[model samples]
Target: MLFVTRSLPSPIWLNGLEALKVTGSKGKGSTSAMIAAILRQLGISTGLYTSPHLLKANERIRIGDRLISDGEMDASLEWMLALRDSYESRHSNDNFGAFEVLTGAALYHFFNQRPETIVCEAGIGGRYDSTRVIPGRITALTSVELEHTELLGNSAELIAYDKADLCPDGGTLVAGKLEDALLPRLRAYCALRSITFVEAAAEISELKYNSAMMQFKMSCAGIDYGTIETGLVGKHQARNAAVAIQAVWHWLQCSKREVEEQRFTRAVREAFKAVRWPGRFERIAEDPETIIDVGHTQLSLHAVAETVREMNSAKPIMLVTGVSYDKNVRGILDELLPIATEVICTRAYHKGSPVETVAALCEAIRRGIVWKSADTIEEAMDLAVSRAREQNMTVLVAGGLFLATEAFVHLSGGDPRLLQFF
Candidate 1:
C-alpha cells in the first residue's frame, strides 16, 4: 500500500510537506479543521483532509477555505485509478478500497497544490488507517473511549495505545483531556517509543452559547488566549479548540518556525471565530429550531445530548436519529432516549442501521417515548418538522454521519440521494 502512494508522480513524502495527523474516539474532524484554520490565519497555505464528509467527497480534501475543485478531483482520481490498476496487475490478490483511493487522491491533490502544511484526520484507529502515510511529525489524540473494539481494543488504554501509533519515533503526541487511569498508560506507551507526550490543558471559563454562536475564554500554557467565539456549539468544542491550539503550537515548534506569543494568540482567536465545521451541533433551521450533529459513539452521543439539554432546557425535543450498523445501538439510545419527547427512527442511504432496529432499541430502553420509524431521512425530517411545529419543540438530528449528512441535505432544500459516501 505504501508502494502505491510512493509511485504517485509527486508523492506527498517527497514534497517536503509538514503534516499533522489527528486520531481519537471523537473530535478528530473538528480538531483538524481548527488546526488548519489557525495555520491559514498565520498566512500559511494549508491542506486539510478529513473523513466522513458531510455532503460531497470533495469536502474531504480542502486547500485553505476552498474545497477541491471538480477538475482537480477528477484529475487526481484518474491518476490514482491508473496507478491502482498498474499496481493490482502485478499483485492480483491485493485490491484498494474506496478510502485508500480517496486518501491517495487527496495526497496527490495536495502534492500538486504544494501546501506548506497538511492536516489529516484519521478515519479510524491510527495503526491501520489510510492517512498514516502522511508522515506527520505531530499527532493529536483527542479524547479516547472504548470504540471500534474489534479493530482498536476493548479497553480505553488499548484504544489510546492504538491511536498513539499515529506519531513516529522521536515525534510529539499531544493529547486532549484523558481519563486519570488511561493517561499514565498512554504516556508510558509514548515514552517506550521515544515519543514526546504533551497533555493539552487549558483553563476554560465564561463558556456561554446562544442560537448563533458559542463564547468562551481560554488560557493555555501560561498564555491567555482571550475571548474565543465559534459557531460550533458544546463545551466539548472548547476542549477541541484547546487541543487544536496546543497541537498547532507543537507543530510550529517542530517545523522550526518562529512563534511569537502575541501573534500566535491573535491567530488562535481569529481561527476559532472563522472556522465552520458542519453537522457538529450545527443549526440548519430556526423556525422550529433544527440542529444536526454527527455523533455516533456512545460518548459522543452523550456529549451532544448534554449540550442540547443545556441549550433547550425549557423546551421539549423531537429526536430524529439513526446509527450505522457497526455502532453500539443500545448504548447510543441510552444516552438520547431520556431527552427526546418524540423519537423518529430513520436510516441514512448508506450503511445506516435499519429503522426498525433502532425503533426496537428505543422501545426496549424507554417505552412511552412516542417513537415512529421512517425508511429514509427525508421522511424522518418531514415527520419531525410537522410534530415539532405543532408542539413547538426543538429537533435534533443525530446518531451517525451519513444520517446527519442526509438530514442536512434535506433541511437545506437539497436532494439527500445526491450525497456521496466514500
Candidate 2:
C-alpha cells in the first residue's frame, strides 16, 4: 500500500523533518491544529496537514496559519500526479488512492517550505495510514471509539492499538481521555514497545466549558498552565487542547529545547485561544443563529447536543443533518433528535446518506417530531433558514463532514461543486 508513495522520486518521506502525528476516532484534527498553533506562537515555522477539507483542498495543507495558495497547491498536485502516472505506467498492478497522493503532495509542499515542525492528523486507523510514513517522534491518540471496524477492528482496544502504532519506538506517546478499562492495556502496549506514555487526562484538571468559551488548568513538563481559555466551543476541545499541549511539550523535549515556564505557558494559552478550526460547532450566520457542526459519530453528536443545549436552552431548535453511508445513522440521530423541534433530512453532494433513509430513521425514533426531506443541501438550508426565522428557532447542522462542507459552501455563497477537490 505504501509502495506507491515510497517510490516517488526524492519523496518527502525521507526528508527527516520533525513531526507530530495525531490519530483517533475524534479530536485528531483539532489537536493537530492546536499543536501547530502552539509551535507557530513560539516562533517556530510550523506546517499542518489535516483531512477532509470543508471548502477546498488547500485547507488540508498549511504552513504556519495560512493555507497553501491555489497556485502552489495546483503546482504540487501537478507534480505529484505526474510522478504517480510515471510510477503506475511501470507497475500497473499497484496504485495509490487519492488520499495517499494528497498526503504525498502535502509532504512535498512542506519539505519545500522547510518548516521547523509539521503536525499530521491521520485520515483513519493509523497502522497503515499514509501519514505513518513520516518519521514523527511525538505522537498522540486523542480518543478511541468503535470506528472503521472493517479496516481497524471491532473493539475499542483493537482500534486503540491500530492508532497507537503511529508512535515509533523510543518516542513519546500521549494518550488522551480513554475508557477506564482501556488504559492499562494501552500502558502495557506502550511499555512493551519502549515508548514513553503520558496520559493527558491525568495532566488536565478543572475542565469546564459553556457557550462562550472553555477554561481549564493544565500542568505539563512540570509547569502549571493556570487558567487557560479557548474560543473553541465544546468540552471535548478542552481535552484536545490538553493532548496538544502535552504533545508540544514532548516535541520540544525531543528537539533538546528547554522551555521557560512563563513563556511556554503564555504561548500555549495564546495559541489555543487563537486557533480556528472550521466545521466544528462553527457559527456561519446570524439573525436566526445558524451553527454547523461536523460531528458524525455518536460521541461527537452527543457533544453537539450538550453544547447546543447550553447555548440555547429556551429557544426552539431546527435540526438540519445528513450522515455518510458508513456511519451509525441511528446512533447519530438518537443523540440529536431529543432537542430538535423540527428536522430537515438532506444529502450532501458526496457520500451522503439518502434523505429517505435518514427521514425514515428519524420517524422510527421519535414519531412526534416534525420532519421534512430535501434532495440537496441548498434546498435544505433555504427551508431550514426560512422556518427558523419564522419561528425564532436556532438552526443547528450536524452529521458527516461532507454534509457540513456542502452546507458551509451554500451558506457562504460559494459553488459547492466548483471546489470538490478530494
Query: Which prediction has the highest TM-score against the true structure?
Result: 1
Model 1: residues with Cα > 4 Å off, grouped in runs: 10-15
Model 2 C-alpha lDDT per residue in residues 1-422, reported as the tens digit of each score: 35544655665535567789999998888889999999988999989999878777898999987899998898788878887888789888988689988997887787667787789999998888988888778999999999889999999999998999988888889988899999999889888989999988536667666554667787765778888888777767877888998899888989888878688889989998888888888878887888888877998898888877655458899999888888999999999999899999998888888898999899999996756799999999999999999999889888877888788888889866665746
Q: After superposition, how far is residue 105 of candidate 1 from its true place, in Å?
A: 0.7
Query: Model 1 Cα displacement at 258 (Å)?
Result: 0.9
Tens-digit lDDT string for candidate 1 (288-406): 88888888899899889888766656878899988899888888889988888889999998888888888888888888774689998999999999989999998988888788888
List TM-scores for all candidates, in order.
0.96, 0.93
lDDT of each: 0.88, 0.85
lDDT, candidate 1, at 322: 84
Model 1, residue 236: displacement in angstroms? 0.7
| Stretches of model 2 off by over 4 angstroms after superposition | 1-15, 202-212, 216-222, 417-421
Shift in Å, residue 130, candidate 1: 2.2
| Candidate 1 accuracy as TM-score | 0.96
